[model samples]
Target: MMPGRNLRKPAPPAAPAEREVAVECALQLRRIGDKWDLRQRILNFLAKLFFPET
Candidate 1:
């Protein structure tokens, strides 16, 4: 599962300004997801090393 995946789809914006806002929001969410993914992977790797049986 990816972080911020729910932000992938938002209600359609009607106005031009709304569209811009939506785009910006999506970009920011994507960046957040990238950071989360890196951290999550690191944690998972550590967990696997500490608990190999799981």
Candidate 2:
């Protein structure tokens, strides 16, 4: 076994409040009525989902 290696820490779990906030944000996105607002949100989401973050 390699010394002082293979000891990376696990990713921290998301907090309950963070999950709630994320849910609230998704709900808000659906509630947006303006076409431009919806389009921008979808495009941004797609970019984030498909493209590597810079």
Candidate 3:
């Protein structure tokens, strides 16, 4: 093996259940209507769903 090479396998991607939980959390944040920045929160949620890595 080359020096400094990572021998262990990479971690598995996030499961569907985990992703669903994240989405639900985002939706809940969006649903809190009393917050002053509700529109930005909703947009952030949408952005997370569509661009998770970024």
34 Cα displacement, candidate 2 (Å): 8.1
lDDT tens readout by residue for model 3, 1-54: 999887998889889999999999898877775474877888899999999999
- Per-candidate Cα lDDT values, in order, are 0.93, 0.85, 0.87
lDDT of 1 at 14: 81
TM-score: model 1 vs. ground truth: 0.59
RMSD of each candidate? 12.2, 12.0, 13.5
Query: Candidate 3 clashing pairs?
Result: none
lDDT per residue, candidate 2, 4-53, as tens digits? 77877898988999989999998887777566787999999899889958
- As for model 1, its CA RMSD to the true structure in angstroms is 12.2
Sort by TM-score, best first: what order?
1, 3, 2
Error of 2 at 3 (Å): 23
User: Could you tell which candidate, 1 or 2, scores higher by lDDT?
Assistant: 1
Clashing pairs for model 2 are none
Question: For each candidate, what TM-score against the reference?
Answer: 0.59, 0.38, 0.38
Error of 3 at 11 (Å): 7.1
Measured with C-alpha atoms, the lDDT of residue 48 in candidate 3 is 98
